[model samples]
Target: MRKSFIYALLVGIMVAWGLNVTALKILVDHFAPVTLTALRIFTAGVVVLLFLWGSGQLRKVSWNEAKQIGVAALFSVVAHHFFLSVGLTRTTAANAGLILGLVPLVTSLLAMMFLRHRLTVFRLLGIASGFCGVVFVVANGDGGLGHLSVGDVYVFLAVLAQGISFIMIKKATVEARVMTGWMLVFGSVWLFVLSLVLEPGGVSSLKDGTPSLWMIFLASAVVATALGHMFYNQAVQHLGPAESAVFINLNPLFSLLGAYWFLDETITLGQLVGFLFIVAGVVLGSGGLDDMSARFRRAKVAAGGRKVGM
Candidate 1:
């Protein structure tokens, strides 16, 4: 696949995930957070499994691959979702969104330490710019920096777990779809077990859900969790972790928009400016500017050769 296409898909994934923040916020009101997360992940895992089976892509993993997938699921799905769902209950979506924006930085740091990925000056600048953008949006939002809540800590833990998972995903030898499917399946199982221990009444609550709530749940599971993660995992395979993660900076911008549309939240002028910083950050952090410059230089050299030949 072309890099441009992968980047575009990443952006789409960000949109789905950004809107998912609001969807999750809505669903949490009607269902227990851990139970809801388990159900959502299980539903998404089934969809992916069905697709893989139909497409002749489903196959059993070796013991080694299974182990890798298991570890990855522990971090990516179980831990990440556990923290995120629990955190959302205690904190504002805006706060969660801002905290989630730190994923790229954390992922990059992990990549550097574990994967030996170099931290280029461009990437450093991009990370800084992207983080600053998130700060701007959150700091300028309705109640800027209004005391850190325990929810914020959970969300931050979610970010760290997800970052580590990305590193594992990058290192995995299995196919992206296969990894994603199994990871979700395994993670959901763990989450369900946790829910049983901590939220014994959670599953029963689902029976009382209305059609609209179920609709939101399915949308979150299918569109956001299933498709979004599938695409993201594929992108990670192609682009590597750090470069792909830089795109996550757009999450807060999209989250801001999602909040405005769904939650009737106000958008501030500072948030608009933050969007610019985020765009620049993605471009720089992802080495997009470097690519453009190289292309331009190559074109110029070709043109000069043609002029001499003429």
Candidate 2:
């Protein structure tokens, strides 16, 4: 029963995050990217605070923790979202979703570089395939392999920033709930200030926006940010990080389907091929094959032992 519940929760998380890309794509059409990001982060931060306070988990963040959180916030939330927002404006959500699927591959490379993790042959192949997939996608979708679109570059940069934050997050000691809330707070402040300077009159544009615009904003803030994070964190607690992480790969699939359904985005042959490569690379890079081998060995030994006992 517990296992079933966790699996269901995992699916929910995947759906929330998957549709999140689609929501952002829609929201960007109604609001400026930075401005939209700022509003979403701010609203989510308030929800986090309220939840923490209600649960008696709210506490003063120490200076050291605050500094760590700040560093993570800068890359993970601020830069990641900034680039993602800008990139989405220039590219289709389907393209963005497929490109972002390389996060695991990038994170693996970063882990090897910063944490002294071993780089295996499988991972190397994974990296190569992932890059080739990106190149193919760019060449077919944008223009040529050599002439990458600005949006693609921005999305790649967003992935890089997110990868760095994934590394930095390992060094932090704060509780996940507290850290995430603070990260949202810091990200909100950073982007809000940025929006003010770079996107003047963006906030006021909301007043004239349609009901669908407000609905997307509310959904992005409440469903995607607040509930998604909460459910994901809960799943991590119940399922452990490794098992929970496998579900994250479903995020791109959701985004791809959602984009097709809502935005009427078409997935071409090249994009589909690229998507396959990226998913395979991510799985291989994350040691799915090694894990399967280990599990098979265990199962074989267990079966052999049982036969002998019989």
Q: List model 2 lDDT by residue over 116-136, tens digit each.
A: 878888888889888878876
Q: Per-residue CA lDDT of candidate 1, range 204-231, in tens?
A: 9898899999999999999999988877
Candidate 2: stretches off by over 4 Å: 295-310
Top candidate, metric lDDT: 2
User: Residue 76, candidate 2: how far off, in angstroms?
Assistant: 1.0
Q: What TM-score would you give candidate 1 relative to the actual structure?
A: 0.84
Where is model 2 poorest over a 10-residue stretch in terms of lDDT?
Answer: 284-293
Count of backbone collisions within predicted model 2:
0
Per-candidate TM vs. native?
Answer: 0.84, 0.92
Task: Let me know the TM-score candidate 2 reaches against the reference structure.
Answer: 0.92
Looking at model 1, the pairs that clash are: none
